[model samples]
Target: MRVGDIDISYDDQGDGLPVVLVHGHPFDRSMWAPQVARLAPRHRVITADLRGFGETTVVPGKTPLGVFADDLFGLLDRLGVERAVWCGLSMGGQIVMEAHRARPERVRGLILADTFPEAETPAGRAARHAAAERVLREGMGPYADEVLDKMISPTNVRALPDVAAHVLRMMRGTSPEGAAAAWRGRAERPDYLDSLSRATVPALVVVGEEDKFTPVDVARRMHATIPGSTLAVIPGAAHLPNLERPAEFTDAVERFLATVA
Candidate 1:
């Protein structure tokens, strides 16, 4: 669908309560295949490739969290969806938070997984800037190869070869220009803790027990800050628990959806 200057690629399926799934940075809508398959049977599951990722237009420059959020709201408007549950992971989770902050009434609930609400630290921002430069210089292959194990647990990389391969393929195939642009934009992200704390809608925070990036403690703190929010820690998974431990992740989402309904 055309939203402003870009064409967003998305799949809208099923026929119940609307649930939009946003993919993380450097990945595409395909990352949500597991969740989409499970949730679409009972709800309207809409998965979209963010600008510069997946099949979407590669803008080659800074695309702020607000831009991503606006693109999503535009998509929802096109679909004629008044309000719906918003579920996202990593960068995608941050986009969901931004969306809720901009238009709280349009967000029915939030499902944040493997994500944090804090603004980027100075050191973190520097690291992101360096990564952006590195990817732009060396392309995505080198970085994808280096971070394969970090994206998922080392044990899972060994045990779930196909999943690991899929993860690697996604990262490697990502446009370096697009990835760099996202990194640049993400470094400027604002803290969303205040927004999450003020939210009156239901929230579900899911994180991988072995997530090195966000860690369990971060998720715990986020869960505690949001009144009446639930936290489910998936064991034996790393950053992408939804793919590494599909059943456990889906089960948590299923229970959360029941409550939302």
Candidate 2:
């Protein structure tokens, strides 16, 4: 669906209370396929391609994460989702924070998976930006492979070839300009620790045991900041535990939801 000037593409399925699934940077709605399959049986699952990632192509000049949040709200409005339990991963987590900041009443609960509330430090941001630029300059093939290798556990990469292939395909499908824009947007997100502290809704902070991208320590700190949020770490997984260890990831989510519900 076209929301404002952006072409917002989403998959809506199953029944019950709404659960919005948001994906990380350089990937699209397809990245949440496993979660959708697991959650849709008991929840109204909505997975969207954030602006500029999947079918949702954005205008070249846009650079704000708030705009992406607006796109999410617009999608909810178009779909008649008044209040939803939000599950966001990485960039998706950033968007969820923006949504809570923008319209707290629309959110029932929060699930932040492998994401942080603030940008990396100046030096770290520079290093990440440089790496991203190198990826763009060199083309996505090598970078996509490297990204998959970093995102999932080695066991999943070698044993679950299909999962690894799908992730690489999703990463490779991203446009270089879009990927750069996403990285830039993420690097500029506001310090949202205060926002997390202020949120009263039930929340969950989840991470993969081997999530070097957003380590378990970061997830623990986030859990500490959020008054009542629960923290869960999926064993033998990396950045995307939901993909590498679907059963464990889904179980944690389900348990969290039971508490929140």
Winner by lDDT? 1
What TM-score does candidate 1 get on C-alpha atoms? Answer: 0.99
Candidate 2 per-residue lDDT over residues 133-170, each given as its tens digit: 87668866777877777888777899889989888888
Q: Candidate 1, which segments miss by more than 4 Å at Cα?
A: none
Stretches of candidate 2 exceeding 4 Å from the true structure: none
Candidate 1 local lDDT, 174-194, one digit each (tens): 999999989999999899999
lDDT of each: 0.94, 0.85
TM-score result, candidate 2: 0.94
**Ten consecutive residues with minimal summed lDDT in candidate 2?**
56-65
Q: Which pairs clash in model 2?
A: none
Tell me how many clashing residue pairs each candidate has: 0, 0
TM-score on alpha carbons, each prediction: 0.99, 0.94
The deviation in Å at residue 113 for candidate 1 is 0.2
